[model samples]
Target: MNSPADSGAHRPTPVAVVTGSDSGIGRATAVRLAADGMDIGITWHTDEDGARRTAEEVRAHGRRAAVRHMDLTELPDAADAVDRLAQELGRIDVLVNNAGTGTATPFLDMEYATVRGVLDVDLIGPFLCGQLAARRMIRQGGGGRIVNVTSVHEHQPRVGAAPYCAAKGGLGLLTQVMALELAEHGITVNAVAPGEIATPMTGQEDEDVTSTSRPGVPLGRPGDAREVASVIAFLASEDASYVTGASWVVDGGMLRMGPQAGSHLESDAWRRP
Candidate 1:
């Protein structure tokens, strides 16, 4: 009798665990991946209802969906949700570290607790979660994908966002290191850095981005969640098998405004932060 390996068994359907999938880019990415024929593991912090809604969307695509709660600020324990979702969904083939938080206080006025919370949610959370996902992928003996959702601040600085920029910048570099180290295991890591997007995080959820105005941004407005999701979907697909350690900027030319913005500013409002 032939053994299981020699029996030509079919592989299970792919599974993806997207953190903070209750809304915004996370929700859009979960739906997009489901449409790509992968089961989804959805996570939410305070928005269980929104997570259920996201799961409904995934199921609408005829893919399996599992829901969990993940509070990144909770630290090493929060990452265990990845393992639970992977087990429930049969396997973990992709991990999108989309859960994060930020602060708007100036550097001098920022509290230790606030800075720590931002770092925990944005940087350390992804770090621990990536470790868990990568271990599972290595054990499964196949390739995997990890997409870290950073910000345009990952490349530039925002006046009011000190800890936020630091966390994102650190995550951007961490993606590269993970890509380099995990290449041997066939796990590609990448960062999706978005500029100003119309998400609840930015107080623009459900807003019509086309109608918004932003003189500093080359696109003249904010980006839709789906726009960012499309790029993330590409990075999570086989088409990006050869691509890794790259930060795909979906910012609508916001980062390119360094010189122009410096010259066009009319007041000291930029320094008030």
Candidate 2:
């Protein structure tokens, strides 16, 4: 919560909108940005208490925080949420599209309802948010930052995650297109792809993921939500002005292993034991 009065004698404090920020990486990003002298607009789905906690943490960092309840799967109203936040929080200097949905289902057995839910939240929702944020930034006459929270599945396929992979893959390309179109306007769009972070989404403790010495990861650890937040904070700042349209992988070298190949012998592979 760095105060504008305390930040410096020059420059206006920035305002940031972080979606799905009630918990996990989104929450961390909001706190980090607040510490960096930015007022925060946070959106949450089901966890009002979590969102309130995040807002309190942001305020503790000395920055103003506004909390909003939103359902990102509602595609038509997604952009409206961003617009509302921008109006409420003043000009939005940074937009982090972190809201997403996914479920574990085999591709062949997946229902249209489930697939559409994932796509609407992960891909289409971000599209709407990006459009709205960019429009606001353009009107504000100042360059802004857009950070999309993608996943490693954006680059590689994952079993039992067909729609999730598809949505993230589309989002990866969409981010590049937005960057190309917005760079001339002094706005930069980039993505942060995290792998095996110790978040509720993975249901694994930090120590549990870190202690299992996986053969491929050079770092030999699972990432913390704050670790990913630090990178997002950097990208949203003046320091990352030149960087755009790139997907920075924060996977502790797990992605470098390519597909999960092992020499383990099994009588019937791909079958539940």
RMSD of each: 5.3, 4.7
Per-residue lDDT over 1-273 for candidate 2, one digit per residue giving the tens place of the 0 to 100 score: 122344465655788999999988999899998888899999999999999999999999888999888897776875587888889987888999998878888889999999999999999999989999999899887789999999988998888899999999999999999999999889999999998788777765334565654444556557888999999998897778899999999888767766342112222233244
| Model 1 global lDDT (CA atoms, 0 to 1) | 0.89
Query: Evaluated with TM-score, which candidate comes out highest?
Result: 1
**lDDT (C-alpha) at residue 35 in model 2:** 87
- Please report the TM-score between candidate 2 and the true structure: 0.90
Q: In model 2, where do residues sit more than 4 Å from their true spots? A: 1-11, 205-216, 261-273
- Residue pairs in clash, model 2: 1-61, 1-62, 1-63
Indicate the worst ten consecutive residues by lDDT in candidate 2: 261-270
TM-score of candidate 1 against the unseen true structure: 0.92
Return the TM-score for each candidate structure. Answer: 0.92, 0.90
lDDT of 2 at 167: 96
